[model samples]
Target: MNKSHKYKPLSFRTLFLILGLLFIFLLIADLLLGSVIVPLKQIYFSIFPSAETNETFRTIIVDFRFPKAFTAILTGMALSVSGLQMQTVFRNPLAGPYVLGISAGASLGVALFVLGFSSVISFGVVSITGAWSLATVAWIGSFLVMILVLYVSTHVNDVTTILILGMLFTSAVSAIVSILQYFSSESMLKAFVIWTMGSLGSVTNAQLTVMATAVFLGILLAFFKIKDLNAFLLGENYARSLGVKIVSSRVLIFASTSLLAGTVTAFCGPIGFIGIAVPHICRVIFRTSDHIILMPAVIITGSIVMLFSDIISQLPGMQTTLPINSVTAIIGIPVIVWMIVKNKKFDSV
Candidate 1:
């Protein structure tokens, strides 16, 4: 008879159940604590109402808050997952979405469209002749940088060097974008700047669908590479010893990350801090380094954090909502700073 070993890893069932309940609590809290005081009864009635409850509450819940909340959750999940994947693939704790130039590439696409395509504007419907063109160019930019990094990875064994190279790629793109902005019209420049601030409120239902599709593809890639990701915690040599194909695994990680980061930036603009912060938050909350646990925890916590931030952005009395990026940065930057300060061996390969 063959002996079977049971993988009893601290009863993940219990841990996940706790986290799920916590997620629900946070979700309800998010719906409740925004600037506008949306009563619990109103929300309940909107979901299941008795004939003539109200339309205002329904509008607020369904029309305004629902979209914003959904956008925040998706953005949070996408960027947090992307950050975790980058950190694992590059074997650098500080690695993030912006490091790979995906954000810059998306920003570049936005810039080109704002400057070049805006000329074709009509009476009411703004022309979208270059929708694919913008997306294609952005994807190409991300892919080229990935290829360069992969090529360098083969030659240079140092993870720090690769990290620096990624930073350099982002910086180079930023320099080019600066030139583009300089030569562009004032209105175009303003548009680019506002877009950079980032906003979940801007995405339409159609745009949300596209963003959701991209997130789905990215998540699929991450799930497929879960085994490789688990093996990767040990360095490349160790992973190679376990029969993991390093090059292909890295490519998959990069492509998936690009898809997530690129799509979020394309639709919602370049959100900062979430990618870097969420993984750290996940680790702290979950208390486990296992990718199996950490991945889902990151996804859930990230969504919650973003939803909370969205609520903060809609401060009471000011019908004009605060910028979504501002709220995220306000809350995320301090956490990120503490992580950096506490981290001692940040230069590890």
Candidate 2:
């Protein structure tokens, strides 16, 4: 008898089922565990809108928590998938939206728009002008940065070099934003400062629509490039040997990354860690690099992490909420440390 005869393949259906249940549980918990702690029965009635439903609970659930929850879902899925794509493209575990300067570029764009027009624009006034303007400028900014990164990739052979260039680019962009902030009006500076703090609660219903649309398109692009992503993981030359069009594939993946990451930054501010940490968690859970399995795994795990973070940020029975950025950093930093400790010689994902 051979050892091969005794091997049995594993099924992920069970794992996926458990994750799905966890996703639903966390989502509900996010809604129910906010400041007021709306009852599950009221949540049901709020959705169905019975006459007996408490108006206060209905207002909190339908108007505030619902949009915030949906924003978390979008943020998680967008950042996680973009992170996976970046890791695959760069063959580095550290590649992500912020690390690559994509979010910085988006932030720069927002800064110019807000700070440049500081005389008129204020924290509260951005909503009155509409969210599309903010999102559009962010898209343009991120696109420009992606184009620059692509140019560098074509000329440089080393992924480490590209990553270094990206960090430099981000630092440069931050300097420019700081200069703009210095000249900005008090109201405008306050607005930009608040944005940097990262609050999922800041997203309005209308802004959520724009975010959802952008994220959906980005995810669609990722789905189309699944084959290309799977190929790239084995190395560019190997991917080319398999007839994958390297240029076009890189363009599409970079574009998808910008859209997903930029839109999130535009709506929710510069969220960190979800993009870097979620993909690695997925790879561990699924124990495979195949994008087919990893894609869905990243989406669900990302959502769970974000929703859980949001709940903690609320501090339950407290009126004061912690910054979403701080919460994510606390959750994400430990994962990065664990990766280093476990791999010791880690260089790439």
Candidate 3:
């Protein structure tokens, strides 16, 4: 048994129960607090389908809010798990889902499809073709980048060099995207720009289904590698001594990260800060480096934070809403800053 587990077994159980209840509360809150304030009773009927449910309320709840809320939960789980994996693999406090440039690679795919093909296709109307095509291209781009990074990792002995190389790939991809944006039509540029801002509302039910599937698989992969992840925290040599195949473990970890982060970016745009910040928040709150404790903690905490962000983004009882990306950055940046300043050693992990 881990020391953290032994010291506060009851506390951990209590915390998990509390967090679970909080998650339910926030999920209901997310459904209730949209542009139009929905009564809890009406919201319940809408989901359960009683005659008491107003048609308008049902449409709002079942069609719009429910998918968005689900997206929030899925996005949160995917990014947080991916972040935890990267931080462990690299043993770097600042490492995130995007550290390997998967986000940038996805962005490049979006840019090429939106901006590159803008000359031939007018995207004034967002269709299934337009939306699904964008996501498909983004996946391909991210997968290709993952393959490249994995290849580099196998050849490169130094993890630091791999990290730097990933950054360089991101920089290169960003430069290409910039060039595409510079020459693109105004309408196409606007479409791409809105994507970058991020919006949970934009995800359709079909897209939500795909996103949920990808995130579930990614998370399942992460759970399978929990032992390897714990081994990784003590460094490669220690992990190797324990018979963890460094290269294979690294590959699986990277694959998991790519799937989780890439799918979210493809569907939701690159929502910032959640990935890098949530794991650190969990580590501090749980007071343990053990993956067993941290994995579930990160999942529930990420969902709670994201559902809260979604509620805030809705700007309840208001006509307008803030961008989801902006809300996440606002909520996450402060947590990260405080963590850094409060712990100069960055030893929370």
The models' CA-based lDDT, in order, is: 0.74, 0.86, 0.83
Residue 28, candidate 1: Cα error in Å is: 3.3
In candidate 1, stretches whose alpha carbon ends up further than 4 angstroms from where it belongs are 1-15, 32-35, 119-137, 341-349
lDDT of 3 at 239: 97
lDDT of 2 by residue, 1-349 (tens): 3432343133567778989999999999999997788888988999887787999988888889988988998999999999999999988888998888898889988888878866544342346346888888888899899998889888988877878887998899889989988887787788889898888998877788889999999999999999999999889999999999999899999999999999999888899989999998877676677899888899889899999999999899988999898999999999988978985534757
> lDDT tens string, model 1, 1-349?
1221244433556766876787677666666556577777887888887776678878877777777778888898989998898777777777788766667766776666665566621210122333334445556666666778789878998777877887787787778778878888787777667767888886666566666777888888988888898788887899999999988888998888888888777667778778878888777555556788778877887887887788778775456778888888899989878766785433431
Could you arrange the candidates by lDDT from highest to lowest?
A: 2, 3, 1
RMSD in angstroms, candidate 1?
A: 4.2
Positional deviation of residue 272's Cα in model 2 after best superposition, in angstroms:
1.0
| TM match of model 2 to true structure | 0.94
RMSD of candidate 2 to true structure, Å: 2.5
